[model samples]
Target: MSKTNLDIQLKTIPESAGVYQYYDKEGNIIYVGKAKNLKKRVSSYFTKTHDSGKTRVLVKRIADIKFIVVETETDALLLENNLIKKHKPRYNVLLKDDKSYPWICIKKERFPRVFPTRRLIKDGSEYFGPYTSMKTVHTLLDLIKGLYQLRTCNYDLAEDKIEDGKYKVCLEYHLGNCQGPCEGYQTEEDYQENIKAIREIIKGNFKDSLGQFKQQMKDYAEKMQFEDAQRIKEKIEVLENYQAKSTIINPRISNVDVFSIVSDESFGYINFLQISYGSIIRSHTLEIKKKLDETDKELLELAIVEIRERFNSKSKEIYVPFKVNIGEEIKVTVPQLGDKKHILDLSLRNAKYYRMERFKQIKITDPDRHANRIMAQMKADLRLSEEPRHIECFDNSNIQGTNPVAACVVFKNGKPSKKDYRHFNIKTVEGPDDFASMEEVVFRRYKRLLEEEQPLPQLIIIDGGKGQLSSALKSLDLLGLRGKIAIIGIAKRLEELFYPNDPIPLYLDKKSETLKIIQQLRNEAHRFGIEHHRNRRSKNALNSALDTIPGIGEKTIVELLKKFKSTKRIANAKLDELEEVVGVSRASKIYNHYHKE
Candidate 1:
C-alpha cells in the first residue's frame, strides 16, 4: 500500500460502472460502494476534501481497494449491496434485526397438529408463514379453532392402537375442542375434511372452505336443528371476517414476493412482503447501515434475495420498484398502476415508516441536529433552493367533456393540510381540453390567493407532463410569479419529473421520500378532483331529468326531489306521493309522462 503502488492501481482502474471494496491494514473490508465510473469515483476520495469526519477517516484507513466491473450501473449497485450485507463491514450500515420470525407449521402426522414454531425442520410439514407478528399467528389459530374440532393430545393416533381402545376421552374432548379421534369416536375420513379446510385457510384460499361451511349450515337448517344451524352460521361469519381482514389486494396476484427499499447516505431500510392469494401473510422491514454510498436498486435487490431465502419463498415473480439484476430464474416486474403498483407502494411505505421511526428514536437524543439533517436532506433530495415546507399539487378531471373540474391539495410540513384544499369548476375551458383546463385552474387558484394575500406554496406539482406544465407556466408568467415558486410536472406514466426549459425529464429514486410525497400529492389531487366532478355530474343528472318534466317548475322539482330523494324514486312514486310533494296538476303531469313511457 505505498503511494506509488496506489497511483499505479488508480491508473489501472477502468472508467466503468462496478462495485468497489476498501480493505484496511488488517485485511478486513471496511467499506463497500458502487459507482458509475470507478476510476473517477475512487480517485476523488484521495484528491478531494471531505467535510465529514467519517469520510476523512475512511479515506485514511483504506490500505487497499478492489473493484469488480459490471455491465450496467444497476448491476454495480446490486453487487455492492449484496457484498456489504454479507460482509457486514464495520463502516457499512447493517440490518438490525436480532429476533427470528414465527412460522405456523402443520405437522404431517396422523390427525395433524397445527401450531406456531420458530424452527424449520424438513419433516414434510407444511409451513404457512414466518409471520412478522405473533398476534397475527394467534389470530389465525383462534379463527381456525372456532371453525373446527382439533385434538390437543400428543398420543399417537395409529389405527391399530385406536382400534385396541387404549386411550380414553380427554378433557379437550369433553370440552368439545376435540372429536375424540383417539377413542374412535370420530372417523378419520371426517376429521381429514376439517384438516383439508384448515389447509385451505392457511394458504389464504377461503372459497372452498366457505362453500363447505355454507352447505353444512344449510343441512342443519333443513333438518330443523335451529341451534345447530345458528352455530354453523356463526362459524361461517367468523371465517368470512378473517378472510376480509387478511385479503389486501387482488386475489389473482397470488404467490409473489414484494420488495422495496428506502435508503439515505448512512443507512437503508428494506421491507419484504410475502403475498399468497393476494393477502400479505408475512411482512418485515430490515434496517441496513450503509458502509458507503449504495444505490436503492442495489440495496433492494440484495434485500430481496436475502429475505426470500430466509422466508423460504418459492415465488417465481417479484414486484420491485425498478429493474435490477437479480437473476434469470425470477421475473422482475416494476408495476406502474393498478393493484400491483398499490402493493409496491404499500411495501415502500412500510420501509419509509420504519426509517422514520428509527430517525425519531435517534432524534429524541439530539433533536436540533436531527431536524437540521432532515431539512438539509429534503433540500438536496428535491433539488430545491429551500426546504419545501409548503407544497401544493393541481389535478384536472373530466368525463367525456362533461363536468370538468380541478382540485388543489395542499401539504404543510410533509402532511396533508385538508383545510387548505380547494376545488374549481372549469369555467373558461370548454370540452375536455386538459391543457386549457390546467391553465384556467392554475390561474384562478393562484390569482385569488395572490389577491387575498394568502401564503404561496414553496413547491407546485402539476399532475402531468410537458403540456400541462407549459399550460401552468403560462399562468405563472402572466401573474408575474413564474420564478417565485419551484414547480415541476410529474407524468402519470413512468413518473418522470419535468422541469421548465429542460427537455429531458429527471427520474428520482423510486424509494425516495421526496418522490413518494410527490406521488401522494398527485393521487390526492386526482382523488379530490374526481370526487368533485362526480358530485357535480350527479347533481346535474338529477336536476336535468326532473327539469324535463312538463308543469314542473324549479320549486316543484325541488319539492319532489326533497321528498323522493332521486329522479328514479320520483319516477317510481305513486300519483298520491307525487301530489304530496308537488302540486296536483304537476303531479298528474309527471305521472302521465312516466306512465306513458
Candidate 2:
C-alpha cells in the first residue's frame, strides 16, 4: 500500500497487451483500463505528470494492481470493457443497470415454437432481435402468426412420437393457427419451408417470402382459381407493407455496425445501430457515467467493444463518426458523405434523443437536482438575473375573428402546475386582435395577482413575436412591474426567442432542455386557448340553433337536450318521441323545423 510497495509491485507486471485493474485499500477496483504494455502503462502513473485532476486523485488512491494478459490489443480492449461493465469500477465509463434487450427466438426444436424472450440460450435456436423495444418483438411475432400456421404447443413431436400417436391436434390446429405438426399431418420438410421464410422475414429480408407468394398467386391464376390467387395477392401486399415500413437505408450497406456518441460533462450516450440488408435491425443507446473527464474517443471505443461483444456481432466493418483504434480484425470507417454518413448521422440523432430522454427521466427521479440544473441552465441561457422557478406562458387563439380567447399556463419548479392555469375569454378585445387580446389577458392576470398580494412568475413567455411581446410589456409597465419580470416571445416560424427592445432574437439549441420547457409552455397555452375557444363556439352554436325554432323557448331546448343528450339525437327523434318529451304543440313545431322538406 505504500509508495515503495507500489513501485515494487509495478516491476512484476508483464510487457504485453492486456487489461489492468487498480484497487483501493478496500480491495475494490477503482479503475479498469487496457494498455499495449502493462508494465510501462501501470508505472507511468507514478512516473509522469497527469494533466487531468481526476487522474492525479485516482493515482493517489491506488493501493494494488491486477492484470490479465491477452494475445492481442483487440482482445485486451474487449476484456477491459467487459470487466468494467461486470465489475463497474469507480473510474471507468459504465452504463448503469445495463440489461440486454429482448430478442425474438425461434427454438431449434420439433415444430420450432416462436416467441419473444430475453434469454439467449445457445442451443441452436435462431434469435432475431436483441431489439430495443419489447413492442417490436411482439409486433414481429404477431406478423409471423398472421402469415403462417406454426405450432404454439410445447409437445415434442419427434418422428417416433408422431408415429406412435403420442399427441393429438388441439384447438390451435382446428382454428387454423397451427398446421397440426403434432399429428404428423404437416410433414417436417413442408413445415421447415415455412420456418425458412420466417427466418428471412425476421432478419429484415422480406423478398423471399414476397417472391414465393407472388409465384403462388401466379400459379393459382394460371389454374383459373381466382379466389386463391386473390388470397395470395393479399399475402404479398401484407409482406410489402411491412417491408416498406421497416426499410430505411440503402440495401447495399449491409452487415455493418454503426455507433455514435454524444457526451456532456458527467455522462456519455452511445447509440448503436445495426444494419442488415440496408435495414436497421437493432437500434440501442447506452448511458455511460464518466468517472473521469474521459474524451469522446475513449468513451466511444469502450462502448463499441462492449456493444459488439454483448450483441455477438459478426460485422466485419463498423461505421463511425471518427477513427477508433479497435484493431485489424474489424475495419472502422469515418464516413464523410452518402448513405454511410447518413446512417452515422441517424445514430448520432438517436444518441442525442436518448440523452434528452434520460435527462427527462432523471428530472422525474431526482426532482431537486433536475430543477436546480434546469433553473441554472435557464438563467444562463436566457441571461436572467435569477432562476425563473415559477414561469408563465401566454397564448391567444381566435378562429375567423370569433370567440377570441387567451390562456395562461404556469410552471412551478420546472414542471406544469395545472391547478394554477388560467383561461380568459376576450371580452375587451372585440375582434381577432392577438396583440390587444394578449394585453387584456396579461393585465387581468397580473392585476389580480398583485391585488391579492400573491407571488408572481419570474419569467413570462408570450407565444408570438415582437407585436404580442410589446403588448404584454405595456401591461407590465401599467402595473409598475416593467423590467421586474423577464419576458420573451417565441416566433412560431423558426422558434426564435425575442426579447424586449432586442431586434436580434436569441436562438437556443433546438434539443436543449430549456428550449423544450419553453416549447412545452407555448404548446400547453395554445392547447388550453384552443379548447376554451372551441367550448365557446359550441355553446354559441347551440344557442343560435335553438333560437331559430319559433315556438321553442330556452327552457324547452334545455329540457330536450337534457333528455335527448345531444342536438343530433333531437334532430333524429320521431314526432311522437318529441311529443312524449316536450308536449304535442311544441314538439310539432320542433319536428317541422328539423324535418322541413
Candidate 3:
C-alpha cells in the first residue's frame, strides 16, 4: 500500500477495544497486538519512536493493516492470543512447546474405564489432565487403581445387556482387580459413587475419598471382615500419603494458577503452576524467545494466556509476582505474605531453575551463545557502554606488612585466561600501603601493555573499596585512559561494588550470575597474589642467611646451595666437598661463616 492509503486507513480505524494485525506486502501477518483503544494504539505505532531496532524494522515492513473490533478488552485479549498462536507472527515472542502431554481419561461407557492416553477425543468422556510427563500420569493412574475396584476391560455393562447375559467375568474380575460389572456383579449407583470419588481425587482433593475409605474400613471391621478392613485401611494410608506429598500450602487456596518469570536479554522463562485444594496438579515452564526486548510484564501476561489455553485451565484466579494488565475476567493477585507469597516465590524459583538448566545445556552445546549472553548480562548489570569481552581484575597481598605484591588476572569471555595472569612486586611502595601499591602496579601493568601495543581490557576490577578504586583511576588518568575503560572496586566486607565518581555502592544480588563472576575474578586475583607473595617471602628468608658472608655473592651462594641444598647442609659439608662446588677461597670463607654460626 502507498503512504496515502496507509494514512487513510489509520484515520478510519475505530476508537474501541480490538486486536490489530500488521501485514507485509505479500500478505503475511508479521505482528499481532491488542489495545483498549484501536485508533490510538495503532496510530502510536507509526507516530512514536521505538527503542528496539526490530520494532522499527517491523513498522517499516508493514504494507497493510487489519483489525477485529471487540466489545470488551477481555475479548480483545482473547482474540489477540488466538491469532498470535494461529499465525505465529514473525515479530512476536515465540511460544515453542511441541510435545503432546498425556491426560487421564475416564471412558464414556456403562462401566467406565480409567486409562492414560496422549490423544484426546471428544466422545463425551471426561479428561482430567494434560500432565507435564507420562510418568506423572502413570503414577496418578496407579494411585486410582489401588483405591478403586474399576474394570480394565472394554465391556458394555448396560442393564439390558447384563440381563440378557451377553458378557462374562474376565481375568480382571477373577484377580479381584474389578467388581465384575460386566456380569451384573456391581450396580450402576455404587459404580457412579466410586467414579465421583475418583473425579475428586484427580482434581487433587482427597478429603472426600479419605473419609469414604475410613468409613468403609470401620464398617468392615464392625462386621468382623478383618481382611477387607485391612485392605481399606491400606488404601486410606495411600491416599493420605499422596495428599501429604501434593499439599504444599494451606488447603483453602485451590483452583488457582500461579505464574512467575525470569528473563535474560534474549529469552524469557515463565513458570506456571496449577494448584487445586493446596496441591499442585500441574507445572510447566515456557521459554519465549524475545523479539523486541519485551518486558517481564508483557511476556508473563502473554504466557499466562497461552499456557492456560494449552493446559485447558478454567481457573478464575492467578497469583503473580507483580501487577499486570491481562484483562478483567481472571483475578490477578500480587501476593505479599504468608502461603500465597511462598507459592509465588516457588514459581519464581522454578523459572530461575529452568533458566539455569537451559544455560548449562546451552553452554555445552553452544558455547558462543552462552558467552554472548553472559557478556550482555555483565554489560547491563555493570552499566558499561559495551560488552566486557576481555576483563582484568587486580588484587594486592601484603599480610603482616611482608612481601607486598599484586596480581593481575585476565578473563576472556567470562572465563579465566591463566596465561595472561601477571604478578607484580611492590617496588615503589613501602610497607603494606594497599592504595599506593595498587596505583604503582596499575600504572606499570597498563604502561607496559600500551608500550607493547597489547589489547586493553574493556573492564577493570580493583579488589578493595573506594580508596583503592581512586588509586587505580589516578593511574588510568595518567595514561590518558581513564574514560576509555570501565573500572569498579569490590569491598570484601559487604561485597559492595564502588564505581569511580559514584558515592553510593551497588550491591548486586548474592546469587546473580554477574556477581558470581565478579566474585570469581576477585578470588582468583587474591589467590594468585598470595601465592606469589609466599614465594617472595620464602626466597627472602633463604637469602637472608646467605647474604651475611663478606666475600660470598649471589652466584657463589647459588653454587654452594646447588651442591649442599641448604644452609644447614653447607655448614656441615667438609672443605673438599665445598671446594668441589665453589672456588677454594670462597669455599673456605663459606665454611668458616657457617661453622662459626
Candidate 4:
C-alpha cells in the first residue's frame, strides 16, 4: 500500500489510545499491534525512518489499516486481547499447547483408588492432575501404592466384590506397600483413615498430614509400642522427604511469570514459566515463524496473559527476565546480576529446548505458516486482544421440561478441559425458553465467577441464533460485564453451521485443518451437555419412583442412596431387605404400596 492510502485511513481514526491492524491485498491480515497512543501508534508505521526488514515486509502488503481507540493504555491492553481472539490475525504470538494433558483419576466412591490416564470423562471421580510428565505422575502413584498399600484396582466396592479372603493379595501387598485392604489385612475403619491421610497429602495439605502422622507415631511410642512407632516413624519420614525435595525455586518473587525467548531468521521460540507460591510450573512455549518486534516486553505482555489464563494462574507476582507491564499487584522486575542470573539462564535454556521441539514439530506442521494465516484472518474476523487460547463455550440442555441443566466447558488452545467441566442444575429459569434459560445460565456462571474475582474468558460461544445471542448479551450487560467478554452464537443456517453474530456464516475452505479443529471442539461441547442432561434425567426418573412411595420422602431417599448406592437396587428390593434398612419398616404403609406395584 501507499502513503496516500494510509492518509485516507487516518482521516477517520481517533487521537486516542488503543490497538490497530494492517491488512494486505485480497483482505488477508498482515500485521497486528497495540498502541499506547492510537494516533501516534498508527502514524509511526508510516514514518520513513520506521523501516526494518520486518516492518518493510509488512508495510508492503498493507492494503488498509484499522484502529480501535480506547480510554487509556490499560484499556488498550485489554481491548487488544479481545481483538486478537476475534481476528486472530496472522502475525500474533500464541503460547499454549493444543493437546489435552493427562490427569490422575480416583473414582468418587466409598473406597476411592487413584489411577493414571490421559483421557478424562464425567464418571463421578475426583481428578488430581493434567500434570505435565507421565514419568513423574507414575512415580508418585507407585510410591503411594507401595508405601501406603492403598488399593490400585478399578473394581468398585459397590459391586459386592469386597470378599477379602477370595482374592489373592497382589505383589504390592508382599512389598509391605499395600494396606492390604483388598485382603482384609487392614480393618475397614483403619483403611478409611489411611485413605483420608493420603487424600490430604494429594491435596497438598502436607502440614496437617505430617502433623497427624507425628501424633500417631508419638502416641504409639508413649504406649510402649516401640515397633509400631518405628513403622509409623518411617511413614512420617517419607512424607517429610517428599515435601523437602519439592522445594520452590524462588520465594521472593511471589505471583510472578518469568519469560525467555530464542529466535533466528526462520523461526522464533517463546518460553513462558509461571511461578505461584514460588514453585516453577513446567514452562510453556510458542513458535512464531513470521517475523516481529514481538520479543519486546510490551508484546510479551500479551503472551504472558495467555499463559496465566490457560493455567488459571493464581500468582500475584510475575518476574520476567525482560520487563513487561501487567495487571494485579504485579511487579515486573529485570534482574541484572547475582542469584537471579541462574533463573534467567534456566529460562533461556527452556526457550532453546522449546525452539528445537518446535523445529521438529514444524517439519510436519509449518506452524509459522499456519499461525500467519490464522492470526491474520482472526483479527479481521474477531478484532481480538492478540490471540485466543483459553476460549470457553456454554450450552444449556433439558428433556421436555425435566432435568434442566447447563454445561460450561472450557477449551484451552482449541481442545476441551475435562478437568474444568461444570454442570449447573439450573434453578433460576423455567420451561423451554432457550433465550431466558441461556440468559439465566450465563448470568449465574459469570456472576459467581466475577464475585470470586476470576478473569473473564476472551470469547464465549453459545448454542443458538439471535435469541440466544441477545439473551447472553443482556445477562452480561446486567451483571456489568458486557464488554469484558465477547459473545458468539453458533446457529445452523439451512444446512450449514452459521454464526449469526457474523454478517455471514463463516464457511471454511474444505481443505482447512483449522476448521476441522474448531468443529471437533464444538461437537465435544454439545456431546458433553447432552450426556450430562441425560444422566440427570435418568437419575431424576429413578428417584421419582422412590419419592412417591408412602414412607420415602426426599430425605429418606437421600439416606437410601447414601446407603444402598443407587435406585436400581432399591427398586428391586424385597420387603425383608427394605425393612432391614435404617428408617424403613416392614409394616409401614410404604411397604404395601411398593409391593402392590
Candidate 5:
C-alpha cells in the first residue's frame, strides 16, 4: 500500500468503536489495537510523535490498515484480545504463560468422581477451577473428603448392575471414606444432595453447608447420640477452619475479581484475585512483555480480559485501582476504602512480589537484560534524555577543615566500577569549602577525561543541596559541557535531589530501584572520600613525627618504615634490628629521638 492509499483508508475509517490491525510490507499483521473511535486512534498513531523506538518502528512498518467495526467498546476490547492471541502480532504485548494449571473436575458419570486434573475434556463434566497451584486444589479436596462421604471409584453402578450384584463395595467403603454408592446403600437423590453442597463449598459459599451441619449435630444431640454428634461437630470444625483461612474480607463482597499491576520499562505484572463470598478462591499473576511501551492501564485492561478468560471466570464485578474500559457487562469499581481497598492493595503486593522474583531470576540468568531494565528505569525516573549507563557521584570529606578531599565513584550499568574510583586532594581549595571543592573536582575530572579521550559519565551526582549543584554546574559550563551530561545533587536530610536551575527538588520514592542505586552511589562516594582523608591524615602525622630527627631523610624514613612497618615499631626495635634496615647513624638518630619523647 502506498502512502496515498494509506491516507485514503484513514479518511474512510469510521469514528466508532472497533479493532484495527496494521500489516507490514510482507502482508503480515504486525499490530492489533482496540479503540473507542477508530479514526481518531488510528490517525493519532501517524500524527503524534512516539517516545518509544519500538512504537515508531511499528508505525513505519505499516503497509496497510484493516479494521472491524464493533457495536461497543467492550466488543472492541474482546475482539482485540482474541485477534492478538490468535495472530500474536509482532508488536503486541506478549503473554508468556505456558504451564497448565490444575482444575478440580466433577466427572460426568453415574456417581461423579471429584479429582484434580490438568486437562479439560468437554464431556459435560463440571470443572470448578484452573487453579494457580496443585497445592490449593489438594487442600480443597482434602477438606471436602474430611467433611463428606463420597464415592471415589470407577465402578459402573447402574441400577441393572446393582440388581444383578455385579459390582461390590470396595475397601474405601469399609474404611468409612465412602457411602458404598457402588452398592444400593446410597441412593442417587441422597448423593445428589451431597454433590450440591460440595458445589457450594467449591464456590466458596459455606453458609448453607454450615447451617445443614449444625442442624444435623443438633438433631443427633437431641437423640442422645453423643458419638454421632461429636463426628458431625468435627466436620463443622473442618469446614469453618477452611473458610477462615480462605476468607480475607467481608462475606458480602462476593463474586468479584480484583486486579492490580506493578510495571517496569520492559514488563508488566498484573495480579488477579477472584473473590467468592469474600474468600480468595483464585490468585494468579500474569507477566506481559511490553512491545511499544504500553501504559499500566492498557496492560491492566488487556490482562483482565485474558486472565478472566483463561481462568473461566464469570465474575460480574471487579475491583481495580483505577477506572478501565472493558465493556459495561462487568461493573468496574475503583476501590477507595474498607475491605475492597485492602483486597486491591493485596493484589498490588502480589504483583510487586512477582516482579521482584522475576528480577532476581533474570539477574542470575540474563544479567544484561537486568542492567538494561535498570538503566531504562533510571532514565525515566530521572527524566533524562538517555539511559544513564555510566554515572559518577562526588562526595567531600573533611574533619574540622583539615585534609579536605573529594571522591568520585563510578557506576557502570548501575553497579560500582571500583577500578575507576578517583580521589581528589582538594589542591586549590585552602579550607573545608564543599562547594569550591566540588567545583574543582568536577572541572578537573572532566578536563582530564577529555584530555585522555576517555568516555564521560552520562550522569553526575553531587552529595549536597542546590549550592553544591550550582557549583558543579559552573564547572561544567567552564568545561563547555553544561547540559551535555545529566547532573543532580542529593541532600542528606531528606534524600532530596536538586537539579541545576530548578528550585523545586525531586523526591524519588524511597523504595524505587532508581533511588536505591542512587543512594548506593552516594554512600560509596562518601565512604571512599572518608577513607582517602583518613589515609592523608595518617601519612601527614607519620611524616611530621619522623621528619624532625636530624640526618633522617625521606629515604631513611621509608627504609625504616618498610622494615619496622610503623613508627611505633621502629622506636621499639633493638639497635641491631634498626641497623640492619637503615645505617647505624640514622638508626641511632631515630631511636634517640623516640626515647627522648
Candidate 6:
C-alpha cells in the first residue's frame, strides 16, 4: 500500500472505465473497487501521501492489479459489489454477515394476523417490510396485531371450532386483542378492515386511525361485551402511544421520501426516510457494497438515485443530502439544524442499524454460482455450447401494468454486476400484459446491444413461464440476435424452469443453492424496477401538486421545497418559518394561500 508504488501504478494506468482489485502478495484480494477512470481513482491511493503509514503498509504489499473496463460508473458499481461479495476481500471494512433485515411477519389465516419474524418463507402470507430495526420490527408487530385484533394463532381453528361457552377465548381474545373470528365473534370483512387499519397506521395516520379504533371500542363496550371493549381499548392505547411519539415530529407532509449516503473504502450505506400524511413514519437503510471509489458527495448523489429507484414518485417527495441530477424541482439540501435535522438523524440511525443487521454478513455463496450452474445446466439440459459467463435476468413491474418498466440485472462469475444493471420503461405495451412487456424489454435491450460494441451476454432470463420466454425470443429473433444469448424462463411456485424451445419444468426440486440464486436475480430485478416506477410516480404526483399552487413559479417551488421538507409541511409552517426559507416572497403570497394557519 505504499504511496510511491501506487503512484507508479497510477502512472501506468490508462484513463478508462474498469473494475480494479487491490491484492496482497499472497494474491489475496485486500479490496475490490470499480472506477469510471481506473488510473485516476486507483492511483489516488498511491499519490496522496498520508500522515500515518497504515495505507502505505497495505499498498507496499500490493503484488498485482486486476481490471476490466466498463461503459459506465453504474456498471463499475455492479462489478465491484459482485466481486466484493464473492471474494470477501480482507482490506474492505466489510459489512460481513448481514442480508435482508428482520421484517414483521403477519401470518394469513382465517383470523389474519401479524407477527415479527426474521425468516421470509414463500408461504401464502404477505410481508410488509425489509425493515432495518429489530426493535422497530417488534414494536410494529405488537402495534399492528395488538391494536387491530388480528389473530396470531398457529392453529387451524375453524368458524365452528370455538363457541363462546364451549371454549374460553384465548388470552389475546379475552384481552380484546384477537378479533375472535375463530368463534364467529367477527366476520372476515371485519378482520380485513383491521388489515387496512394496520396499513394506515404504518402510513403515519395513527391519530386518525386511533379515533376510528376508539369508536370500535365504544361499540363493543355499548354492546355490553366488556371483554371485547377492553381489547379494543388496549389497541387504542397502542395507537395513542405511537401518536404521542409522532408529536415529536411536526406535521406538514403529503407523501415523500428522503435519502442520504455515506461511504468508506470498501462499503457504503444509504439511508431511506419515508414520510406520509404528516409524520416521520418509517425509514430504512440499504448497505450498498458496490461503488466506484465514491467521494462523500458521490455517495449523496447515489443516495437519491438508489432510493428513487426503490420508491414510487406519486407517493413521495424526495429530500436529498446534496444537489442531484434529478432534473426539475427535486429538493436537495445539507441540514444544519431544525426539523430537518430530526429527520436526518433518524435516517442516519437507520443506516447504522442496517450496517449492523444487514450489511455486516459475509455471503458464503458467490452469487455467480447460480449463473455458472444455470449455464452448465443449460449445457446439460438444453445442449448449449458452453457455460454462460454473462447471465441476464429481466422482470417487469407496475400496478395494473401502468408505468410498466423492466429491469435487467447482469451476472458474471456467480455474482451480480450492479454497474451493468439496466432498466427499460415498457414503451410499446399497454395494460397488464406480461408477455408484451417482456417483448418490449427484450427488444429494447438487445437492440441497444446490437448498436453497442460491448461483449454480449451468453444467457437471458425472463421472469415468467413459456409465454414470457416466447415473447422475448420472438423479439430477439426479429432483431437477428438469436443464439447470441441463450434465453430461458423462470416461473415461481413449484419454481418451474423453461427454455425457449423446451417444455416448462415445474418445481423440479432445484437444490436450495440453485433456487437461492435464481430467486436473488428475480428479487433484484423486481426491486430495481419497482423502485424506479415508484420514485417516478411520487415525483409526478409532487409536480402535479406544485402546479396547483398559486403564484409559485418553478424556481419558487424548488426554493419552497428546499426550504421546507415537503410541500405539505410548508403549507403547515408559520409564515415566519416560511419566509425564512430561501427565496420566499416578501409579499407572502405563498404563505397566504398554502399555509393552513
lDDT of 1 by residue, 1-597 (tens): 877878898999999989889999899999887788999999999999886677789988988989999987757755776786689788775654333788888888998888898888999998887788889899889999989999878889999999998899989988989999999999989988988989888878889988998988899999999899999999989988888887999999898989998776567888998888988888889876655465687677667766776667889999998897676668899999999999999999998899889888877887765655555566787688998788899998888889899999998777799999999998887689999999998999889999999999988999999999999999999999998999999999999999999999999888676788789899999999999999999899888987888667898887777787788898999999878877688889999988995
Residue 396, candidate 3: how far off, in angstroms? Answer: 0.8
Mind giving the per-residue lDDT tens digits that candidate 6 earns over 15-39?
8877899877687888776677898
Q: For candidate 3, lDDT tens digit of each residue in 208-316?
A: 9999989999999999999999999999999999999999999999999999999999999999999999999999999999998889988988898889888999999
Can you list the residue pairs that collide in candidate 1? 92-291, 93-289, 93-290, 93-291, 94-289
Candidate 3 residue runs with Cα over 4 Å from true position = 97-99, 159-170, 549-552, 559-597
Model 1 stretches with alpha carbons more than 4 Å out: 3-21, 32-60, 65-86, 96-99, 263-266, 365-369, 378-597
Report the Cα lDDT for residue 118, model 4. Answer: 74
Model 1 local distance difference test score: 0.86
**Model 2 over residues 1-597: C-alpha lDDT tens digits?**
888888888988989999999999999999999998999988998899987789899999999888899999998887887787789887776654445789888899977888989888989998876787998888888888888889988887889999999999999989889878888899989898999999988878887898898999999999999998998888788878887877888887888999999976567899999998888888988887777778899899988887886777889999998999898989889999998999999999999989888878987898797788688788888999999999999999889999888899999988999999999988887777989999999999999999999999999999999999999999999999999999999999999999999999999999787899999999999999899989999988977887899978999989998999888899999999999999999999989988999
Cα error, residue 219 of model 4, in Å, equals 2.8
RMSD of each: 14.5, 11.6, 2.4, 27.1, 2.6, 28.9
lDDT of 2 at 396: 91
Residue 184, candidate 2: Cα error in Å is 3.2
Tens-place lDDT digits, model 5, residues 304-371: 98898889899999999999999888999998999999999999999999999999999999999999
Which has the higher TM-score value, candidate number 2 or candidate number 3? 3
Candidate 4 matches the true fold with a TM-score of: 0.49
Lowest summed lDDT window (length 10), candidate 6: 358-367
Error of 3 at 165 (Å): 5.0
Candidate lDDT (C-alpha), each: 0.86, 0.89, 0.92, 0.67, 0.92, 0.68
Candidate 6 wrongly placed segments (more than 4 Å): 1-18, 43-52, 69-72, 99-101, 129-134, 157-175, 214-238, 250-338, 345-597
On TM-score, who's better, 1 or 5? Answer: 5
Whose lDDT is higher: candidate 1's or candidate 2's? 2
- Which stretch of 10 consecutive residues in model 2 shows the poorest summed lDDT? 91-100
Candidate 4: tens digits of C-alpha lDDT, residues 297-316: 54467767666655455555
